[model samples]
Target: MMTDQPALPAPPSAEPADRLLADLIALRAAVLAEAGERLARLAPGGDAGAGIHNLANYLALRGHDLRPLQRRLMSRGLSSLGRLESRVLPTLDAVIEAAAALAGAPSPTAAPDPAAFFAGETRLAAEADRLLGEAPGHRRTRIMVTLPSEAAGDPGLVIDLARRGMDVARINCAHDGSIAWRAMAAHVRTASSLTGRRLTVLMDIAGPKIRTEAVATPDKKARIAAGDAIRFVAEGEPRPTADAPFSAVVSLPDLVTRLAVGDRVRYDDGKLEGVVESLAPGEAVVRVRRAKTGGVKLKSEKGLNLPDTALGLSPLTAKDENDLATVIECADMLGYSFVSRPEDLDLLEDALARRGATESRLGLVAKIERPEAVRNLPALIARASGRRPFGVMIARGDLAAEIGFERLAEMQEEILWICEAAGVPAVWATQVLEDLVKDGVPSRGEMTDAAMAARAECVMLNKGPEVGRAIELIDRLLSRMDGHVFKKTPTLRALASW
Candidate 1:
């Protein structure tokens, strides 16, 4: 109302021009400042380097529509996080910090402005809210299966299973070659085409399929006289005079030296038991523990655990080394079996790199079965996580032996939490669907565990004698979880975040 200045023109419809300019400047400042901070975080000692998934937090902090930003960035050649947290992870915190700083400096909201970017951003924010309700796919439980070459060869099976309820299909490359996998994958494709369904195919590479040296078959049971000590015949035949209940791939030097006469030797968890009768260098002679012991089968390459003794042989096998040469592709995911050390992960990553999987679009599922792998899982996960950032599979059968059966359950749960916090997927395996495969029904204990696993990203099922029902039951269990109220989930939190 100053008389010294000429009368200003009326604003058209709404909002003054100065406020609009302020908003544009504020938004630009936000972008630049956030970019700068994120670029800084990419430096040393930042959480981004340690593999933190900060996107979710960033969106909440900045009061920005996360989904639209995500999509817009993707449209602009930015990586969509999906499950690859590391790719989109760093800038979240930076974005929030920058938004706050920009708001305070020029202050986009300081003076009322014609909603600069308000409409577009609001729409994006709404969409992000919807997406948050969907939660991360990892929130839903995942089911895993190990496909043998024979099963893989049949396309009908893969398709039917997907239609029936197979979330994921696993290919175990330890037992077959690329050609064999191709046949199975061909069927998988056929099934997908026929059913019009998406099935995530996962391949489990045989990192270390360990086994003892093979031995000749014996018709009668082998026997060591009460006082006669014999070497652990690595490459020997079972003689006609041999008489024992079962065969053992004895722990050569370690077991032979530790076991004394009258001690017990149990094979395959009491399938056969014998008493140590005598011992020699790299050898032990044991008499049968069972009364009715003649004509028992004796074979090589079997597991022999002398909980008290340490075997010199490493967990990694010659076959595992050989399998490293195999190529992996046409699958959405991968599993590194028998992983123990960071070096082991490095080796697998090298293998994956050789296969042209360095970008890590494919999920890398680590099979933590070895006790050493379990003990070193965090580091193993971190190293492999950097390469592929996929989840981990608690390969329990071997894990039980490695960490002891009593601790397996607790260990598995811990793995679940670690994977969850890191936003990595996890597949629980081994004996999960044993009863269902062996008989037609699943045990209550198994069902409970399966339900719990469904809460995880993936649950793995071994192909029983009949694979069809296994797929069906798995589908039923997973589907039922959709309406589950057992545990509080993020979808609800996302709903209430505002």
Candidate 2:
């Protein structure tokens, strides 16, 4: 004899669905409002305007914590919004409509048009083709190989590289003069003609990069270790004699005068890190805090990094202006090094204009190697892409030095995502397949790194003796990865092993 009982209204099965729908609707409104506000300020138009709007939507969506919402959506067999970098609004709308349907509510809006939803990817691909040259038929990622000095004299080398799938030839103005750069450009042109393919030349204008100028040490074998004090003096100033501890002069003397006590300094690509201990009329004393196991030999010409100091140095130097005369003549693209702000790009644009180089004639690639650039990336992209075909380079060596090595992976990923949102191509640079290029053998870690680089529109390889082999390997790797991943989204192609 059981008494009739209620089933507790079936546990209100629709409650979670209703809550999810409400959250989606709220998110859509917030994202739209933010994008509208940002676009209002930009007043962008044309293709660039479309990119700016998508970027704004992406930034707004990322501004919120979506982990909880994502989990709920996944549990309900709906899209979790994990891969919406390129088309933010469309993704949000689709999710909202699906949630509404499940909750027995009217759809929030009509389904998005497939073409409009996928326009971001299409624009990005076209921009990449315009800026970095079209990708090879087999692989979507283009290869940019830095031309060795010998490439100027060795036409065979340039032709061989082109045959090996080198899409762009990079000429580093920091190392070579105008004559060499012109020769390299000529060789690249010749190779393009011979191969019947387009070969773009990118000339990297050396910015005001600080480096050790003159090193003064007690003995030829002098080395620096943890707790050792070293003095940084202005170049051409009275150097410390052998009686004093190790000392070196920096390329920029004004930077030394501006360094305050407790400022962090890194040397030799961060092999030796130090802190400012004292300052004088023309010298700043630093105490080494970290170094290699035993010590690092004091050397001249090593890069000097001031991560903690705010360097008011201009990204363009007098030499850069001089080099632009030649760069504008032959190069299809300009790689602006150490670009920290939108104003830096303005300076480059002004220089290009002065040289009568229009945006259509020369594309610009802003090298992101500073913390400021990372923080101001969105603004940088807007300023650059609004003017011309633009790309961003993850100059990881200096970037890692500026923002600790631990953050390198995370920052690079963020940069790729942001560039994709803006429909701008990104060049994955700095030591891709370094060991393989240098030693003719790929490390397991570097193979993985090369695979990751497939996300970028272009992969740059520094000049090396074995670069041909590296190009072959990277080309194959990129083709394979194309079947597996695209940006942050997994392609989910059928597993061959399975």
Candidate 3:
């Protein structure tokens, strides 16, 4: 037993407390100054208004390095500013007031209004309901399934999907004609009525076709391997001789002409990658840099990705303009593919306006799949949401090919945060449960991916034979994950696993 030594003086709190208060005040001022114009431009009396203001505040706040400040705040049992994505200003004000109180100094700010503090979450929920329809009673995340061509002829299939919890039906304009799309839309409507659930039909417009037009191999059976040379030729260019290097024609001739030496090119969803070895008027020779051990087949119609190239091609094509006639009539939402800028949204808006599809009538979803889109996301969100109901789809297939696989995880999280900040619904798309849907066998990785997807407002599954099973499994997964997390916040519901 030791005699009680005089209690050590509490580690001097006054200096650290004062520093925290000052840092917070400075941070608040910086946010307001940087985002003043954007805040002022937001229209009042809507979900978008407060959410956008907070988004602007968050963008500015994240511009500074706050790690040191966070550590100091944590030492004093005050907020570390780590979970302030939705309510940026309110969190700062609360932390500042607490710091002042702890230091026995005059409170620099008054208490935050409770309503203002929670408005971001409320608005985000409202926006999700408006754009994606209300989530099911059991879960907050909605499920969107791409309709296969067979869906046009099978009413039972669509109805079963609805019964299994398909909240939204996606019709890809890249595949079928208007008649088939109308049939698919009609099936969705029938399914909705039969299942007694409100379902949304989203028609995705095919932006630009950057695909392989043809493939010419010496043996016709040899696959592309690492160190192999392949020439990318333009349409109408003469095919290389059998003895010449293996060659493939690109659908976009102009794009091929613009490729410079050393530019990276990915094929078939990045299964194979190469670098430009040389460039000519109508073709570029690429040396394969990475592939499977043996080799991989290069097929016509597979997608081609140029991550290092600046492709200024418009998202709209002649085919898309024609497809809009069906989209404007049948779709509850329009998916704008490859939308990389504010102007891309404007072009689509104008087109919709010409067709008498007002903002209230159709929801617009910007499919972000390019680096430029990631860079310009804030402007794109502001432009779209300021006009009408809006959402963002993380088109991961092309995005991973563009921004590298290593950055995909980080970028998707950032995207989710920004979308949450603006009260915009994000649809987690591409390869959600590919193995299970296509082969009736789920992988451990895909199962984990599906669980992680619950953080998004919606999860999109591509068409496959066993998609109904995929839908049911993801529905259960999302429901389970719902009690554990929301956006980046971890909910501490009592755990049963202990």
Score every model by TM-score. Answer: 0.60, 0.94, 0.93
**The best candidate in terms of lDDT:** 2
Model 3, 1-498: lDDT tens digits are 787788543443446567767878888888889777555554333445667778888888888887667657767888548888888888888888888897779877776788887778888888888888888999999999999998899899899999999999999999979999999999999988888888999999999999998787767678889988888998775366543468888998877888889999999989899999887778888889998778988788999999889888989998999899999889988999989888898898888778787658688889999999999998788777757778999999999999989999999999999998888999999999999999999999999999989989999999999999999999999998999988777898899988
Error of 1 at 89 (Å): 17
Superposed Cα deviation of residue 284, candidate 2 (Å): 0.7
The window of 10 residues in a row where model 1 has the poorest summed lDDT is 127-136
Q: Using TM-score as the measure, which candidate wins?
A: 2
Query: Runs in model 1 with CA error above 4 Å?
Result: 1-139, 212-280, 284-301, 304-326, 485-498
lDDT of 2 by residue, 380-451 (tens): 988876577789999999999888889999999999999999899999999899998999998999899999
With candidate 1 superimposed using the best TM-score fit, by how many Å does residue 351's alpha carbon deviate from the native? 3.1
**Models sorted by lDDT, best on top:** 2, 3, 1
| Model 1: per-residue Cα lDDT over 304-378, one tens digit each | 444334334343455554544443446666666656677766676665566566775666667887666666665
Give the count of colliding residue pairs in each prediction.
15, 0, 0
